[model samples]
Target: MSKSQATPNSAATGAESPDAILFREGMSRAAAAVHVVTTDGEAGRAGFTATAVTPVTDSPASLLVCVNTASRSAQALLANRAFCVNTLGAEDLALADIFAGRTGLQGQDRFTVGAWEKLETGSPALTTSLVSFDCRISDARVVATHHVIIGEIVGIRLGERKPPLIYQGRHYHKL
Candidate 1:
C-alpha cells in the first residue's frame, strides 16, 4: 500500500492562498473568443475588450460577462442597464487593442475606430464583427475583483462570416 499525503485546506487551515499571478497564468492557457462589450445611456457610452463573456441559457436567451471593477466601462455598463457583445473577426485585432486601452484611447475615442450601430438596447454594435448580441442587464453581482453581469438577449445582428479572434497564452490568435 502507498502512503497518502494529506493536503491542507486553505479555507480551514488559514494557510497561504494561491496568488493572483498564478491564477491568471493558469487562466491564460484557456483560449477564448475576443469580444468588445459596449454600453450607452444615462451613464454615457463606454466599452472595453473582454473574453469573459459566455452564454448562460437559451430558454430566455441570456449571457454573462465578467468585468474588472476597475475597468473604465464597468460603471457605464451597470448604469446603462444594457450592453452589446460584439464578437471580433480575426481581422479586427486593431479594434481590440483600441478598446483594451492599449492605444491610449479612452471613453468615446475608442469607438472612432469602428463602424458602430445600435440595435434594440442602444448599445454600439460593430458592423464588421462576426456577430453582435444586444442585451438588457437582467442581473449583476460582485465576485472577487470582478462584476458578473448577466444580460438578457433583446436582439442580435449577424455580420460577415469570418473566423473569430481568439486569445490564449497572453496573446491573440486566429483559427
Candidate 2:
C-alpha cells in the first residue's frame, strides 16, 4: 500500500503524526510543471519561479497557485490582484534559476533576464514560454506558510510546442 493509504487513520487515531520532512520527501518524487508567476501593477512588478500551480476548475477557467507567503513577490501579487503563469520550456532552465532567486536577483530585476510582454491583466508574460495564462486574482487564502491564490483566466498565449521543463526529485527534468 502507498504511504498515504497506510496512514488513512492517522488523523483520527493520532497514532502516526504527519512528518513534514517525510511528506516533502514523498512529494519530491512527483513531477510538476515549472512556471514563472509574474505580476505588474501599482504594487510593482514581481515574479518568482513556482511549481505549485494547477487547474482548479474549467467552468470559469480558474487555476490555483501556491505562493510562499514570505516571498517578495507575494505582496505585489496580492496587492495587484493579477498574475501571469508562464509555463516554461526545456530551454528555460536558466531563466527558472534566476526567477527562483538562485542568482540573488529580486523583484523587477528578475525580468531583466527574460523577454516579457503584457497580457490582458498587464502582468508580465514570458515571450517564449510554452504557454502563458494571464489572470485576475479571484480569491486568496493563507494556509500554513503559503498563500493559495485562485485566479480567473482572462487571456492565454500559446507558443511553439517544445519539451517542457519539469521538476521532480528535487531536480529539473525535460519531457
CA lDDT, every model vs. true structure: 0.93, 0.93
- The residue-level lDDT of candidate 2 at 155 comes to 96
| Regions more than 4 Å wrong, model 1 | 1-16
TM-score of each: 0.91, 0.94
Instruction: Tell me the tens digit of each residue's lDDT in model 2 across 85-111.
Output: 999999999999999999988777788
Candidate 2: which pairs clash?
Answer: none
Q: Which candidate is the best by lDDT?
A: 1
Which 10 consecutive positions of candidate 1 have the poorest summed lDDT?
1-10
Candidate 1 C-alpha lDDT tens digits along 1-175: 1223233467998987656676687789999999999999999999999999999999899999999999879999999999999999999999999999999999999988979999988999999999999999999999989999999999999999889999999999999
Candidate 2, which segments miss by more than 4 Å at Cα? 1-6, 15-17
lDDT, candidate 2, equals: 0.93
